[model samples]
Target: MKSIFFILIFTFSLNIFSQDQVLDITLKTLDGETTNLKEVTEKNSLVVVSLWATWCVPCKNELDAINDVYDDWKEETNVELIAVSVDDSRTVNRVKPLVNGKAWDYTILLDTNNDLKRALNTAIVPYTLILKDGEIVFRHTGYTPGSEDAIYEELKKHL
Candidate 1:
């Protein structure tokens, strides 16, 4: 049990230490504007792209968890959180009201077709990738009480 736990910790740390995979993927915003992924990450100290959905329980939970400490993350480190909603056409319309009601302090973007999701190779909601200098340094899927703290540490590495 101890060995497995240590291995898990080691592997997760390795994921954090890995170099960023340069990917050029464009996505459309909810308002119908196009955005290039590279354009957002390039020349930035830290850019976090999160793939989430309005109908996903864990997705909402992770966003809510992050929202709880987003301000603190900003104050401590100028980490920019770009939340890309993967909600399909059916649930897409609900995003705005949901975000407004939650008062999340992160930027909300839409990916209705899941192009960005496939381009990023993640099939799950709450998929988070952290980039520094336009290079992916850390990535995590799902959330727990102390996971945000771990992500904050990753952002600090590039700051």
Candidate 2:
């Protein structure tokens, strides 16, 4: 009975702790404003948070592909994409110019210190996750040519 009770309590504690692990991290905007991920998730019903770096080509491609059809996705599902750049201090300067050049319509957040990256336990660039009501519904890493279709299909399922 004692062993069983301890197991149950441990599982229950994990359930509560996992929810805030990612959302509690602080993120910065392009203009140098700070905000919590929890606040952003609370306002939007569905949010797509992609962790990318300025120097990663695959990350840029993934964001560009999504940007092409982003408007349609928003209209159909009312989903918002928050592109979180994991660029470190030395290379962070390139983010703004690249974003302007591509004109991506995303809520760009900077993680210059990699705090959010560490919180998410992400190992690579182009990490993407879909959150609904602050809970992660789907998560995928890496990108392929037609991955956007799959992403849209996943978003549709959550709706």
Candidate 3:
């Protein structure tokens, strides 16, 4: 009977500890302001966090594709996209110029030291996450030509 009780207690503990959510990690904005990830998510019901780097072509393509239809997506679903640059200290300076050149309409944040990336256990660029109430609802790694459509479809479900 004691062994069974111990097993039940362990199972209960596992359930309680499994609710892991993103913590408030500080990141820099393009305007050189420090912001917290939790603060950003609280502003919107649903947020799309796109992790990308300046040198990644596929990441740029994914963002550009989303840019093309972002307005429409917002209009229909009220979803916000936060573009996170995982560019280390070496190429972090280029983020602003490239963003301006492309004229992306998403909130841009800089993860210079990849603090958020490591915290989230993301292993690659072009990683996208759908966050609801600061909890990660969906995640995708890598990008294809039509992946934006899939992203939009996922966003629609929460709307």
lDDT of each: 0.79, 0.87, 0.90
Flag clash pairs in model 2: none
Candidate with the larger lDDT of 2 and 3: 3
lDDT of 2 at 98: 92
**Cα deviation of 110, candidate 2, in Å:** 0.5
Model 2 C-alpha RMSD to native = 5.9
Clashes of each: 1, 0, 0
Name the best candidate (by TM-score). 3
lDDT of 2 by residue, 129-151 (tens): 89988888787889889988999
lDDT of 1 by residue, 1-159 (tens): 999999889877765554467467676655678887677667567888888888888878888888888988888888889888988889889998898899888777888888777666566678898977777777799877777778888888878
Cα TM-score per model: 0.80, 0.86, 0.87
Please list the residue runs of candidate 1 whose C-alpha ends up more than 4 Å from where it truly belongs after superposition. Answer: 1-19
Worst 10 residues of 1 by lDDT: 14-23
The model with the greater lDDT, 1 or 3, is 3
TM-score of 3: 0.87
Off by over 4 Å in 2: 1-22
> Ranking under TM-score, best-scoring first?
3, 2, 1
Clashes of 2: 0
TM-score of 1: 0.80
Best by lDDT: 3
The alpha-carbon lDDT assigned to residue 123 of candidate 3 equals 61
